[model samples]
Target chain A: MALLGILLFLMIIGAVIAVETRNLLSSIVCLGAIGFLLSIVFLFLGAPDLAITQLVVEILCLVILIRATIHRRVETVAGNREFVGLAVTVVMLAIVLMLAISMMAGFPSLGTSVLDRMAQAPSHFYLLQGKAQTGVTNIVTAILLDFRAYDTLGEATVLFCAVMGALAVLRRSARRRPEEGDAGDEGEGGAE
Target chain B: MSGGTHQGGMSLIVRTVTRWLKAFILLFGIYVVLYGHVSPGGGFAGGVVIACAYILLTLAEGRERTARLLSERLAAVLAVAGLLFFLGVGLAGMVGGRAFLDNFLVGDSGAEPALASGGIIELCEIAIGIIVSMSLFLAFAVLSRFRVSLGDGDETATGEGGAS
Candidate 1:
């Protein structure tokens, strides 16, 4: 718990620095740091699957974001208005944290043992029979690919559509006129 | 602007390190996907790992080489192929008179914790891994290919090779 608290604190600091930085690259780096910390938190929560996904996703996002800002000039605020924004954000975060703490009072206390909690949940059931039913030792994979495959399918569809749409938007030829296809400068070698 | 006239990649140190590391990273990604049933990483995580390997290549090597290595059309085709493969598995279950995505190879599945244990689940994971890795690589390829109109008659690249 203490470790989690420290990690969360560090994540918060990283996030603040990311938002407040003048350099776009620095902000992206800080964002990556926060993402790594979140993956560590996920690992601590006994979800290595999620941790792996988060870590890789963070790296890809960092690469893409860095590429985005590489050609563009960093947007430098002229004055100390960013400080005011940071102050408001800190105040808002404090209130949300206070509310969250107050709400936690009514629920199960922190650091409760897993056995002491809801044992009759679907997770427990999955843990018990996942291997026998799906023949996979990793219950998470079994559940994702077997019991909840439709969800995975939906996610795949969403990803496919999103990427295609992004490609459409980023296409330089798409912005050009329809007559430009005959020009042939916008073909396969465009990646260069 | 740097590495002018070369258009190769980052510094010599990065390229050297990546040359030695890329193969290991690709191997690790394959291991993660294949052994997902017995390990913490499944299709999604493993696919991202594989895509990261390519992304690493794109970072160390230039966009031109990476694009030539894995063309945009091939990546798109792989993405569609993966989706179809997953759907094919689901339909195969239906042909066996079971519901979609039903594990039909339970009888022939190996030991409980072995790599061959998962009947259709392992195949599904592989399919998903292909979809994710291909699509992500496609996205990066296209993004890196993007060129901004500078209006100065000097329209260089916007990403990967040599960012100004």
Candidate 2:
């Protein structure tokens, strides 16, 4: 519990730094830190799979953000008008914190009742019958690959489509010839 | 100028570490994808790991080297092949009078957890892993290339008459 509290405190600090930092790289690094902390929190909550996915996704996000920000200049913040934005941010943060605290305070008892009802739910059915029905030891894998195969297929298709779209968009410049010699040389240099 | 100058990627230390660690990361990813049915990781997670390995390689080495290793064309082909393989596995279940993606290989369920235990699940995992890894690598490659083109355009706009 103390460890979790420390993690939450660090997460809050990271979130604040990510939002308030003027340097894009620092903001991205703070975001990655928050993601790492969140993954640890997930592991503490007994979701090792989620933690692994979260960590990898966080790394990928950091890579993508860094690539995007590589050639861009550092962001500059306006001083006087930024005060209004800060005030608004503080107000929003206070409201969210109050709501989150209330939710956390109310969650455990509410979760117990929900879990009690869910004990007799389909989760129990999967826990008991998943192995026999799917011939897989891991219930999650059985559910994803056997019981819920169609959903997974749909997700795969969506991923494929998204990739296709990205490829199409990015390959446009490659398809078009460079209009000038200087641009062509620069393109070759960049490609190398 | 000195030939020792590394113009593209990071310093020597990072490049050396990345070179040594790349193979291990790729091996771990394959292990995760293969053992997904019995382990915590699945196809998507393993695929992401594999893609990250390549992305790291691209970051450490130059783009030309990475592209020569796994070109965009190869990545595209692999992505398509993975999707076909996944669909083929699903369609194959229809042959044995089962539903799509049905686990037809009802072998001895009481046997030890081996490679061939999960019927079509393992096959699907491999297929998904290939699709995801290749597609992600392709996306990264293309996006970086596009950013280069954008940068080139900026340079051209700035140096239009001056270069002439």
Top candidate (TM-score): 1
Residue B135's lDDT in candidate 2: 86
Q: Per-residue CA lDDT of candidate 2, range B10-122, in tens?
A: 55777899999999999999988888877788888899999999998877775666777887789899999999998998898888687988777743467766667888888
Worst 10 residues of 1 chain B by lDDT: B149-158
Write the residue-wise lDDT of candidate 2 on A1-192 in tens digits.
788889999999999999998777798899999999999998897767778889887898788777766545653645576778899999999999999998888565521544365677777787788777766776778788887888888888888889999888656544444453334455434322
CA RMSD per model (angstroms): 4.9, 5.7
Question: All candidates' TM-scores?
Answer: 0.83, 0.81
> Least accurate stretch of 10 residues (summed lDDT) in model 2 chain A?
A183-192
lDDT of 1 at B99: 90
> For candidate 1, lDDT tens digit of each residue in A64-100?
7787566456444376568888999999999999999
After the best TM-score superposition of candidate 1, give how far the Cα of residue B89 lies from its true spot, in angstroms: 1.0
- Looking at model 1, residue B127 earns an lDDT score of 91
Task: Report the lDDT of model 2 for residue B93.
Answer: 88
Steric clash pairs (candidate 1): none
Model 1 Cα shift for residue B130 (angstroms) = 0.7
Best by lDDT: 1
